[model samples]
Target: MSAGNIRLYSYWRSSAAYRVRIALNLKGLPFETMPVHLLQDGGQQHTPEFNDLNPQELVPVLMHGNRILRQSMSIIEYLDETWPTPPLMPATARERQRVRAIAQMIACDIHPLNNLRVLQFMDKTWNVPQAERDTWTRHWIKVGLDAVEDTLCDNPSTGDFCDGEQPTLADCCLVPQVFNAERFGVDMAPYRTIRRIVQNCLAMDEFKAARPENQPDAPAPGGN
Candidate 1:
């Protein structure tokens, strides 16, 4: 498969979109990124055109050939299956399960509580103060990453990256969550294993290119 006509609807700072970007880059796939600003004009994703593309109105929607793919993890798996070189998954089924577990710990358990939509709802629906929301975000992030740190440290399978010295689906998910955590001032000192893995990941051009700041839609430095 040539991975022909690939396009991604993304937001620069969206962790979900960031994961997909990493997967695409790791697979050496060239893609067109269609920016969907989640905060501008009450969210470009809510627009009629975008709604037709994905009723969930979430970013990280991937269009490959004529197929429409939603959800960051699914998109990454699709890419991995479609393009197997530089495989992002381990060889055995059990190892793949471990990778998915780590990925979901962040994507499913941690991210939902602090995603922009949830924070916005807290502010608009209940009038949660910004400082309080920041606290809430930091709390959940700490709780989640604390478990992730233990998971990585305890598992002998863990190597330079999330699994076996190469960036896996787990690393794709982990780095973005760590980015959000750092942006909100969550302490990273406690997650030594995760910090080490993320450092290893960022050293790679694929991961560097997928950073939020490297995205075209990212706000100008010191301008946002």
Candidate 2:
């Protein structure tokens, strides 16, 4: 509602937070970012103030007017509903469903299993070794990307981007997942379609600006 006062609780490397950033930039909206260091002192998201804002203790809680939106995809949908310029979903019902399915193939099917908290739990609580953790991350990411490649290869609707020539919600979700995959040392040569799509999106200013390394709070080149 309000113009310049929008605030985003974010971590530079967070894939979920990265999705919301891309959506906001695509909508051409101005918002301030509040960096939440997810690893500092056991994660600032767990602090009382942030917990009150979002009990889930996640980065990327968007504050617009009095509304606090949680969950990356939900926030992106809300932005689409509120702003509606360069629509992220297709006009037809079937097309919209297809777009959402592609987006979920990454957001729902891939990201959650390898999120930071999940890995932390596996390492700390379960005592899983680092090699196994890398294996876990790579496994889920590859499975999701394989599904994406199959879906896009079959669906004629898929153009340069996930749904069409223009970047859609699916592209928003896909790019970040690709970034995560690279981070985990996953071999992406198997998913040729996904790799091509990610390359296309990377060339766009909107997606380029939303990259984790491009964020103001991003860690230095090799630093975590």
| Best by the TM-score measure | 1
- Runs in model 2 deviating more than 4 A are none
Worst lDDT run of 10 residues, candidate 2, spans: 1-10
Model 1: lowest-lDDT 10 consecutive positions: 215-224
Q: Across residues 1-224, which tens digit of lDDT does each residue of candidate 1 receive?
A: 98779999999899999999999999999999999999889889999999999999999899998899999998999899999988999999999999999999999999999998899999999999999999999999999999999999968999999899789999999999999999999989989999999999999999999999999998999855
In the order shown, the candidates' Cα RMSDs to the true structure are: 0.7, 1.1
Model 1 clash pairs are none
| Per-model CA lDDT versus the true structure | 0.94, 0.89
Candidate 2 residues 162-216, lDDT tens each?
8888888888899899899998998888888888888998998888888999888
